[model samples]
Target: MDMASVQLLPDDVLADILRRLGPHDLAVSRCVCKPWCAVIDARRMLPADAHLLPLSLAGFFTVSWTESLTAYFSRPCASIVVGKLDYLDTDDARSLSVADQCNGLVLLHRPTLWPDDQRVLNPVTRQWAKLPPYPHLVSPCMKQDSYQREDMYLVFDPSVSPHYEVFLFHSVPYNCYEVDVVDEDAFDPAVKKMEWPPSSYTLRVYSSKTRQWETKPFIREGEAAGTIGDMESALSPGHCHAAYWQRALYVHQHDFVIRMTLSNEKYKVIKLPLGLDVRTDDEPEHYLGKSEKGVYCALLYGNNRLGVRIWFLDEICGKMDWLLKRDINLGNLLANYPWKHGDRSWTTQYVNDEIGRSMTPAGAKFESDYSTNDNVIVPEYTVSLLGFHPYREIIFFRTSFGRAMAYQFNSSEIVDTGYLQGKGPHDCVGGSFAYTPCRMGKLSNNM
Candidate 1:
């Protein structure tokens, strides 16, 4: 009874007909043969398509804080995930960097070390996990802290839990002390009854299902946006971007948004769309994501149209806010592309000298000897968003003229998806994370 050839069924009836297929039809029924791809890879049957599809952006990691480098942008037929993390066995996996990525996990850290070995990568199943040194850096009040800033964040959800969490997020210096101080009014009423974003806070979380490191506590229901000394003012500058959604996490600190929720540990602050002035913004950038309609907040708007606006967090009825949705003006779409070094000002100085001579840092050394005519004056190109599209309405960006774009928003269309090159000229794109690939099978450095 070949109902159109099941090849005489039975591998438990072809896994009950491939469990009613969906994960893009069970990855196109594993190429329809070779015995249904060895019975779908020997019964590991790839099924949790996170509530049925919509997790395919497969590429982009970026990080490059002055060239420690993470870089991995896709498309050139995406030859199966290889961001060259060099198997992260670390003794200096080039001093690591990417401190956060979720769903398909990735936390990596070793930012110039100090108990910062932190691992946890998955780059499409080159599975990894390491993390363990951060129970408050062996507290003695963080070894008598005089200054500290911590940030980690990576909270996975193979559709609700295949177990993964990291979060950290700490800061110190509301009134740091001890320079052999003989009490300067004993720090004046503990810095006037302390309370800048503190109604309660604890957070240290780690848990890959009890592989340890705990601390939770968060309780600040509302009213308190600034003044934890504005988290050491000079307004944020970097390291603050988070998004987990549903199990809650949000966080895009400074000029509002803290959220937290992680199953009732409770936290709230949300406010960043009422004349949106992240301290007179001239772009320090902003982001917090979850897409295909849910939570979003882009905002990088260096006037004169090097645009980006986005926003959408509308909870409605229980009343949450933010509404404007999409403004996009990428300097009039790179002044109409198609340039070839003839116009848009030496094609943006030959795409910033071919992205600083073909992206450096991997062993460095890839120099360039400048050459451009038309009186070279073309220096002004910057747009960096690189996220969103967890389900589409696209939006990933880069460009100080090196290009790594995406932008879809219901097809206002712009694709290019490649080159983010850079190694100097203050090497940019310091953080970007959209990658999405997760079958979540292995990933256990056994705690």
Candidate 2:
């Protein structure tokens, strides 16, 4: 057979060739011919089980006016959107907000308002269900003539099954902080005891399949000084984690940095690393963001830099390690550039620095606009610390600001990946983007 003959090539052979191409080349190849594009779309031109499909690593970031939910590929410069969540819709609502993402599923919560009010579990896919109300206290024991007792309490156990359960912490008249989980299958809110204080109560798990909360009772406590307080102070809506690793549902506590494993209606709490503080002095706020592959915690810090940190729980050590990092440094990059309108004062020292560097005035103008920290001109997208090449290790972000930027780290220098300026309309607040992996066979002709 002639080696150059296309008809002699086997389907697997062509796919192997396509699998090696980059995303851009693959995209262009789709336009070469319909049959070729179809073959590529069918993914038949690539290996059936190759792992280099340009997987994404994503997280959430915030700016002045709106919150940014972003995603990027594992290669430094390749990031595209899979979703965008708006913060305005969730403010002050009883909903848990986006807590965390694991294997494409998110854990949501809804707190109680009244005695009969129930909590909720909502998946990002929009599937939702209600949990039973937390257990409340009944009449305390004493002589029949004793003054009317007035103590009530409630507790919460997310590990509960058929319905995630919570218990009232105190008996009435006194507020309690302790909650315990007794059964993993059926979470009962009716049990009561006068001697059990709020601080000593632990949550119990109830399993849906087993139809009971738990067979064995267990109590998990945090290292923090006080008992779990109001849900807001104790938990950041989007910072918590509920994931499945090793065939078990693992709930990660943001406040205590603890991981609890739920298996066979039993609960076990595992402590994570010591120095991981989700809140930093700079941004002082948190948001949840997701990508095609995993979830990440977003924080804002000094110099108006947006930092994203991805967490992976280590089952053996019972801790989470931070990986897949990206940072946007807008302050320093925009400093000393001339304002677009030329109305703002420009420092002589800064002007001299720009002149001495031979940077053209137009370049300086664009830089100034791009880097400006105006409260009103929120960033639509940020340059990833990675780079722009989809095949290279890259991370990129898109914002309501109508821009897409890329970044990469090369030894000591953090450089721009690629940038698309003015791609957004004036009033758009939320938008999403996705990346399609490139296969090598498609690039053979272009390369």
Q: What C-alpha lDDT values do all the predictions have?
A: 0.61, 0.31
RMSD of each: 21.2, 16.0
My TM-score estimates for the predictions, one after another, are 0.29, 0.36
**Positional deviation of residue 420's Cα in model 2 after best superposition, in angstroms:** 15
What residue runs in model 2 are displaced by over 4 Å at the alpha carbon?
A: 1-201, 204-243, 248-254, 264-299, 303-447
- For residues 1-447, write the lDDT of model 1, one tens digit per residue: 233466567667777676776544665554455566455556542443332322466566767656556666654443344545555565457666677787667787877524458888776667788877877542122334244556778887654546788888665332222234222232244453456567777878888788878887799887777654343332453557788876787877655778888888888888776344443546446777888667888877666326687878987675678887777777777654532221111011111121322232221121121113322214356667778877666778766545556778877887655446565443676677776666563368642
- Supply the global lDDT for candidate 1: 0.61
When summed lDDT is taken over every stretch of 10 residues in candidate 1, the lowest stretch is 343-352
Which segments of model 1 are wrong by more than 4 Å? 1-18, 21-57, 61-72, 75-194, 198-227, 230-235, 243-246, 250-259, 262-265, 268-419, 422-427, 437-447
